[model samples]
Target chain A: MTLEIETGGVQLSTPILPASGTFGWGTELKNLVDYSALGAVVTKGISLHPRKGNPQPRLLEVPCGLINSIGLQNPGVDAFIQNYEKELSALSMPVIVNIFGESPQEYAEVATKLSNCHWVSGLEINLSCPNVHAGGLEFGSNITGVRDVIQAVRNSTNKPLWAKFSHSTHLFHLVEAALEAGSNAVVLLNTLPALAINIKSKQPVLGARRGGLSGPPLKYVALRDVFDVYSRFKCHIVGVGGIIKPEDAVEFILAGARAVEIGTGAMVHPELFIKCRNFMSEYLKNGSYESVENMVGLAHDDQHV
Target chain B: MRDSPTHFQLTITGNEKVGDRFFLLSFENPGVSFRPGQFAMVAISGEPYPLLRRPFAVSRTPEGTLQILYRVVGTGTRLMSYWKKGRKVNVIFPLGNGFEKIQNACILVGGGSGVASMIALARELHSRGTPYLLCVGTKKSGELDPHSSVFQNPPLNVKFATEDGSFGFHGTVLDLAEQHIHSFTCAAVCGPPAMMTAFLERFPDVNAMFSLENHMGCGTGVCLGCAIETRNGMMRVCVDGPVFPGKILLPEHLK
Candidate 1:
């Protein structure tokens, strides 16, 4: 069965990819993960300058999910290139760098710098990180802001650009604005904004007091958004959020996600990508689908294709 | 090619209740040797209730099997207690930087469940012919398994302290350590934050290393969930260290 497909102007050997932040430069878990099963490696978010991230207690685990406020801790763009460029370039798979910044200018600057690295196949513009105080959910929630950041990054490089959005009430407008600003595809549903309280401490559990929620609980929400967005707009959608099992990936594809990024689920099971690929291969064969592309949005009552 | 960390499904060989809430669990080793302070992320083979795998310090038994001394403190450990012999468990081992070997005599301090990490280090020191003292502290005598291999006839020196005054020394482990403060040139500590803080505060001059425990999403470096602020900057407890120099850990880290 054919698992290869094209999304956001980039060719993926498989539809399975690691979500930003969960993969960490795509090389950290080389020993544990089977990179051959991955279509592409998405690095953690990189800003123009180094960030110390949030204070301690950056993560809290609830029933079937996790809440995190890492605040995009990374070694600025330059350092990332210096540290990971060679190793990332050596990988047989494509490397998609997740870039974030405090302003449109900062986003463009990081994009321009990353564009110089030939190994970087695309840029996943992070406009929806909830852990930060600025530039993340702020730009993602505003139509004008989304256009400005994507447009700015678009002007910086000719490489494929995928705009990652958080769950917003105005998600359609944001997607429209991003596509108009030259984003090749839109990554549906970054983590959902949530909070947890420490009853014993009588305060917030996370150091930042709030963090984005990811895991099994997010799968249905992300699928609904992907289906809704795909029906409304003729744009490519990358499905993300709570994909723990292989069936979850199939569900996202049925909901119109051309590609799926596994986040928290991958952390829970390191071999998730390989398991997903094997499952998908068998799924396509059994269903008699021509390709993963043929199966996208098959569940829609009034399919877009 | 570089040796990669192994992830495997191993069967439990033994599980015995040793203390009030403590259990000594043994499983077949996957043939990967681990450093003294390194740990493993463990999960039930097919269970997903706890979602994330729990991290535990890995120790090797005299019989060539791997064991972890865990206290029933949370859902993960409570579930682990029900794991019977022959049950398969998913484990990723030899993760994180371990304690650095010191040339001089050292003091090893462990409190509560943290003492699990010290046993491996103590054995390594003993084999290397390094003189070391292992000081373990717990709330009460019932908290430790005195018959466990860790406390069995090894030519190693060990001391215990119980807060309830039912064990070796009547006060905290730090109180027992006070009498030998000047005997060792360096110290390695793993325990509650308060105890580690006290060790740093009371013995500021001694070079020390501390093993830290934090809520981890992925025992690998990817999650960045276990990042801790240090003198250098934010360091991930999973990759950079589960063991860190006492000097690099900030005061806030101790609290």
Candidate 2:
């Protein structure tokens, strides 16, 4: 009677979750969002150690999207688990921990620490960190490095693993490597590389020469990616791109995404997730669709479970 | 430091001035507060060019609203002009820090839209009951106030100047402030770079603070994208300031 989709052995109350880096340790937005409400809460991309991350001017606002090079600044995994583990345990919804590491060992080390924490539901292996120079996007692109990271983390933790893939021409290869290394799900398309310039100051806007672009600008591109991979592989598709409205969320669901992540729209609208969730509820009620699962790949017409 | 996607619906259509191409935007949210010499990064929300935001100094703080002055230069401005009555804009604001508090008698100098920020300072001074003089210059005083009806009780001793003798004195801000530089305890200036530099040169002894507009990523300091050359060293304008005192920067920086 209701739309219920199972992912990594858990049931999502909805089909929307905040993307990493957009949402902080959950307390910053304690006033805006309730953890019990979302389909799931993806924690900010956490690394092996506390990182000061990038210097000033890390975000650039485009027409409908924003470009960010935050450098994945977070208290390393040890500190993260120590700090967030208890808080995450209190949440009624699935708590996904997004982990970033310099090397395979660091990845495994952090995963192992979180493995023992009962509150952690799954791990999103960050194969893509655009701000750092070493083992950054390079790690996500190389087949051996990608597989090694997925395999190493998989070997270390029993928690369901979701390997995130960067959006590029060769994304299929990265997906292949992740699946080969045995990941439960894959997150398509990190921000595409972008930058800005100050004509008055005559300099590049982002301190980093390049950054990842997100928001409405990348909406169709992300859908194309989801369609590309979904058309090729029936594996779970987590759609992410320029989703600012409820209709946008519906579009992703129809395009074969079991769930969607809101990134750029979150920056422009902090309470966007809560708003999107409510609007989607209306979308579900007014239509013939009884549950979230019914709309999961509705675009393919004739294909309804 | 907490970023939210909240935007302000500024009624900027009727407020264009001689040099005011951009309208400064601020939230009407009661709790929202900002000081003089501070600015907001505003994009027309859907403008094609200048996809990013441009910085403008806060010009004034009306009873419940805030304002900034800017010139229409690129596509962002032309598109911004078309903004309807309730058009809400995406803004990253109260960004960087404002000018230091002025104690004793203060002298304020503004050139065109740069005069925009000093208005907020003037209001702060008014609220604090501090004595101040506001020397503003433009081509015509007509552009001084599109909302002139609101300023019957002003905060500072105001004077005006015009380039073609359209209104006030027929001279630049530096030429006018030359005789009165030492009269005030502090000087805060925001305007065309040339005029700001001239003010800086004239009042070498007065404590002078300036706000430099830089292209920024985040209004916070984490991104070193808004870099400015200072006597002490290079610092991010977004973090270090949109405001810095005269002594901290070299003369060449403006050049």
Candidate 3:
């Protein structure tokens, strides 16, 4: 019944973790979920300084999805370590800190500072976040920019580096670059760039005018990208986009993702973590699979490979 | 009943058009104990097109049913009206903080859809034998029948106000509450932002509990999309409160 995953030397109890931003700072979900039972707690994007995020109407509901332009609203690295380190450390699972920056040096600085903290299990470098004006999309969309930021953060911390990138034409190149720059794993894909307009008002629905689309609709797109990347690389891939049901998680694993991250799905149902775990465990047992790890990349047989 | 907000398949029992652009939707409650002002995130349709669940106040909890008063404002709500009875929709209930304990002789003032949140509070207060008054205001004379089962069965002392002067009082609920303000020591108000703002401006000294509304995503704290400007900076309306002390809300709105 073991559902362990060893990614970049970090042993996860389960293959399920809360995607960054959707899980908040960990404390917000303390009452709503049992954080200690999950694989890891990936916190919201944290920067060097506190962020006010975008103006009003930061979110909008589109067809089978959510479009949010939160602008990476966070309390900065120092405050996070100061205010939430105790609670995060108290959790039984790993604490993978998701950090973003305006530049490679800033990314390195935040990683360097966080590396000293004992509770943080790893670092998830946000290279493809689409909400912000600077840093996120700029570095995430470029190969060299992705390599530089990942390398900079890689040099700063000995912890596992998980370079999270979005679905782009150069996604595979970016993943290759991340691995070359010392990334232990790569997470794909962040939300797809999308915009919804209010025809009556002749204005955009979201405050930022454009936001990332996450939900059930993003599942197949994420699967295609994960499968394409996994076919060429033996490196660990963490698939995230629109993972709601346990079958979605299984699909990601078969598509070659070592683990799956739940974002909007978890928001809708806080108990989704437990449900996914239960369903996955039952599926593994009934199917007579030795372990969830064994199921990874099974679909990428001779034909796909 | 679960400690955390749990998802339940709610069967639509009734959908009544209570007023212009407003509908009172009743669904089979799965025995979740929720206080007044606490809301639920209801999926309008099973389709992915209306992806996010709409946040609605728990208007009433009678027997095995939960009622929500929703206004047809946007795409989600407009689609909700087309849903037929017995249709099942997903709902995560008992989300966010509800109103705190009200002192005796406190007046409850509601405006428009805000009155929906106060109905449960009034019912709870009535059961405790606490002396309270219900004052409701709407744009026209027939927004809500003060003589309906909701108001009349209990024979609750209800006051009415309308902008057109076709109702009991010829002004806003805040103006109607002025005469009764000296008789009560405290107040509980829920309504449109401007109405609540006006109430607080006039009764600065009175301790009032105001249930504020903001555009929400998750209706849980995770999304952090529903931010309310407070004296202590931006707070999530989903977590920090849909309910806040009048004193805290006044400074920002008053300024």
| Candidate that scores best on lDDT | 1
- Model 1: per-residue Cα lDDT over A102-185, one tens digit each: 888899999999999899999999987432445345788888789989999999999999999988888899999999999999
- The most accurate candidate by DockQ is 1
Residue B12, candidate 3: Cα error in Å is 6.3
Q: Report the alpha-carbon TM-score of model 1 versus the true structure.
A: 0.96
Q: If the candidates were sorted by their lDDT against the true structure, best first, what order would they fall in?
A: 1, 3, 2
- Tens-digit lDDT track of model 1 for B1-255: 113567888889988888899898988877776788898898743544678889999877666778888889988899889989998888887788887767889999999989988888887788788989999899988788676666672545898899989978999999988888689988999999889888888888889999998888898999788988889888899989999998898866755
The TM-score of predicted model 3 comes to 0.89
In candidate 3, position B168 carries an lDDT of 93
Alpha-carbon runs more than 4 Å astray in model 2: A1-6, A9-11, A29-37, A49-70, A73-95, A112-121, A130-137, A195-207, B1-13, B18-65, B84-115, B133-255
lDDT of 3 at B105: 84
Candidate 3 lDDT over residue span A1-305, tens digit each? 56888875678988889999898887677766766447888999889888878766788777688888887888889998999988889888899999998888889999999999999999999986432445345688888788889889988999999998888887778888999999999988888888999999899987779888899999999999989998999789998988877789989989998899999887876777888888888888987987778888888876345
Tell me the tens digit of each residue's lDDT in model 2 across B123-187.
77877888877777777656565334223334356777777777777787666666576678888
Model 3 clash pairs are A63-B49, A64-B48
